[model samples]
Target: MNPSTFTVMEGEDNERIDQRLARDMDVSRTAIQQWITSGDVQVNGKEIKSNYKCRTGDIIEVVPPPEASPLTAQPEAIPLDIRYEDDDVLVVNKERGMVVHPAAGHASGTLVNALLHHTDALSDVNGALRPGIVHRLDKDTSGLIVVAKTNDAHEHLAKQLQTRSLTRLYIALVHGNVSHDEGTIEAPIGRDQQQRQKMAVTNVNAKEAVTHFSVLERFSEHTLVRCRLETGRTHQIRVHMTYIGHSLVADPKYGRSRSSPLAGQALHAETLAFIHPRQQEKRTLTASLPADMQALLDNLRSG
Candidate 1:
């Protein structure tokens, strides 16, 4: 077992032991709490829970295993389109069909596996299955994603997401020309009672979800639009778009009919913005439409 120790300094009194340990030790609050639960943390030589109030001159110790395995991480040489990289964060333009991380059947060739092969360390806030993942896009929906490399960065970014301070924008192609040039969808999203696998805009076990959109281009049978997310939920844009009379052009399950010739949902994550976790500066990034999506748009424009 590898052991680590930390000393509480002046001005740290009155803070919760777990919180302070998370900040000072560069580990997740959950990780620190786990140590406390296992009697791996002590205050003034006495084992205590994470909620214990910390005082100055307190001595804390933690014992961790020598190595941590990425539960489903397999080293794959999959090429990644890294948009930006810094000491604390990495921005990636994930292609369609690539799972963000491993699940039951998808244990290999995932983005997490790629990350494990590329980088040496990642934050453990979400658990072994998701290392450094701040947010996620659907498997078929491709676009910008931000990953945190350290616990400090993870905490900061997670807080931003919780407070809805992060900006996420997407572009999509939909069937039919929408009547409204721009509008907002203010609906509560919850699990579908009838279809357990999907989300719906109803009050049953629901949370608030908001999306703002503006039409960008119009064709004979399709329209392109830019969308911004105010509240991120599972299938917010997809469900809301379908609810608002313009289901994205290739969504199989929600729309009136599955697309015959078009590819999977025409949505793409086009923009992302947030405060830098370590640098504390505002950061904004954008990704152009993927080739297949652009080709479809071109065909729609010409026809």
Candidate 2:
């Protein structure tokens, strides 16, 4: 394991070493605490506990094992709901609550882990952690995601995303009756300055995010809408919809508190279209709403 070093910034004043390590290293604080216990973590060349408060100019060092890296995904026996598969590409209807790749607080049972179990032919362009992952959906957002089997395919698919040729659509059940039948939301999305864990629509270091939405159905209080993303920014659909006063129902992060049977924010990746890597053919894929969302809609319709 190669040692990595970082100096505490002024903005990190009085932050816990483990918290800083998690942010800097992108590994969970649990893993960081283990490193602290093993004496693999040091501050200013002296050993310190995970809860040690960091001050400006404090140099921290970490030596972590490769297996403990958030980037290394191991194969698991989890089953995958594959929608389409070819030699060069594979499209899977990722289930809700499954992390797309290994990350902080999510080391296993990820889609990447299942993919590794299914095949060893995943493209390495995104490195060991992501492997063949071309795109991702939020953990609670169930939907279609494409994977590349070869580096050539990964590049081809990525170009489509960069050029805005790749199409992604989502079903969003949002709060309040949407006043308009259809509209476009063009906003810049960036990390929430106050809460680092959440995203917000802001011009400060933000990126162009455009979502075109149309009402699919309207209930007494909520509106079910279809969202088309022109630019894939982090939390684009959620943030944009919330920016327009229609945050998805049950969204723990950006939504108003409400009671619902759905396990997560009522959002689903319903469609994905792109040019095939090998065949150079345009392909579109779709998935039905999961049981929870469908059931919720059914109940709403009945009521």
**Taking the tens digit of each residue's C-alpha lDDT, what string does model 2 give over 125-229?**
655667898888999999999999999999999999999999999999999999999999998887677985688998866778899999999999999999999
**Model 2 worst lDDT run, 10 consecutive residues:** 64-73
Deviation in Å, model 2, residue 151 alpha carbon: 0.4
Q: What's the lDDT for residue 87 in model 1? A: 82
Itemize residue pairs with steric clashes in candidate 2.
Answer: none
Whole-model lDDT per candidate: 0.82, 0.87
Candidate 2 residue spans exceeding 4 A from truth:
1-71
Report lDDT (Cα) of residue 284, candidate 1: 96
Q: Show how many residue pairs clash in every candidate, following the order shown.
A: 0, 0
How high is the lDDT of residue 19 in model 2? 82
lDDT (C-alpha) at residue 179 in model 1? 82
What is the C-alpha lDDT profile of model 1 across 1-303, one tens digit per residue?
467787878987889887887787777775666566445576666557566887888888876534312234566788899999988999999998888887545668889888878787788776666788878898778899999999999999989989989999999998888889999999998778798568889986678899999999999887899999998888899999999888988887677675445457888999999999877899999999998899988887778
The true-structure Cα RMSD of candidate 1 reads 10.0
